[model samples]
Target: MFISDAMAQAAGAAGGENVLMQFLPFILIIAVFYFLMIRPQQKRVKEHKNMVAALRRGDNVITSGGIVAKVSKVIDDNEIELEIASGVKVKVIKSTISTVVGKPAPANDTADKK
Candidate 1:
């Protein structure tokens, strides 16, 4: 007798959210992760692959182990000969190279561009 019947009916009439609205935050999080993290990582891998493929004799490179050396020979698809010092060459796996420091000057270009 003390409680109103309308209040009980109003409580029962409330509805749950739609399925899409329930999952919207998860979808937004995945989209942000792809754009902010995954995409840039893919781009860096592509760039590193290109740089590794373009390696040739006489290009100075820094290895992943932090050794600075000149590429003396490209042995095959997977290896290169690096000259760490005069007459001190070592065979290094191509993927171990971290960065190409600089390309050597062309052999045929004798005239100074000054």
Candidate 2:
């Protein structure tokens, strides 16, 4: 007595339209997240990678920990030595460097010639 042929036919007819309407908000939210959050974060990471890869000795830099220092030497593809004082130095991961604060002075041939 509870089952009806008309009720089954109506649900079948509305299934496609109703399913899309129900999930439309979910699709919109995902699109919003990708544009507003994911895209900018990915761009920043790319810039950071390029900056770290271009590090050279004598470039003054700031670390992620806020330590300001100069690059004394590039130890490898992933590490470097930072001189924070006349003699004090620290070995840090390249990725830990946040910004290049100073440019290395231009090379002077006369100084070396003397």
Candidate 3:
């Protein structure tokens, strides 16, 4: 008669709701990471895909290798001919290009010389 009722004590203890509350912070942390890290990364990948798809001849671009060049020819879907210097050219894969420099404004200086 003096024995403790183990089954009654176990049934009365905090259960599923208490366990879920303990993990609530961990769930929130994962949600924050997805929005702040994963989402932006995916968006940038999409924008880069669009930029690469829109490549055309005469676009002044910088490559991932840090070389700046102008697109001399669109060889095919996979390769391009870049003109790095006058009469000097190199064949590079299309994806090797990184960023396109914005077109320069028209020069105000005239060709007339004294």
Could you report the Cα RMSD, in angstroms, for every candidate shown?
A: 3.7, 3.9, 4.1
Return the lDDT, model 3, position 88.
Answer: 96
TM-scores of all models? 0.82, 0.81, 0.76
Instruction: Sort the predicted structures by lDDT, highest score first.
Output: 2, 1, 3
- The Cα RMSD of model 2 versus the native structure comes to 3.9
Error of 2 at 95 (Å): 1.0
* Candidate 2 lDDT: 0.94
TM-score of 2: 0.81
* Local distance difference test, candidate 1: 0.93
Question: How well does candidate 3 score on lDDT at residue 72?
Answer: 88
Q: Model 2: runs farther than 4 Å from truth?
A: 1-13, 107-114
Between candidates 2 and 3, the one scoring higher on lDDT is 2
Number of backbone clashes in candidate 3: 0
Residue-level lDDT tens digits of model 3 in 1-114: 334687678768978999999999999999999999999999988888788777887889999999999888898988999999999999998888889885444555665452
Error of 3 at 63 (Å): 0.6
Between candidates 1 and 2, the one scoring higher on lDDT is 2
The 10-residue segment with the lowest total lDDT in model 2:
1-10
Error of 1 at 44 (Å): 0.2
Q: After superposition, how far is residue 24 of candidate 1 from its true place, in Å?
A: 0.5
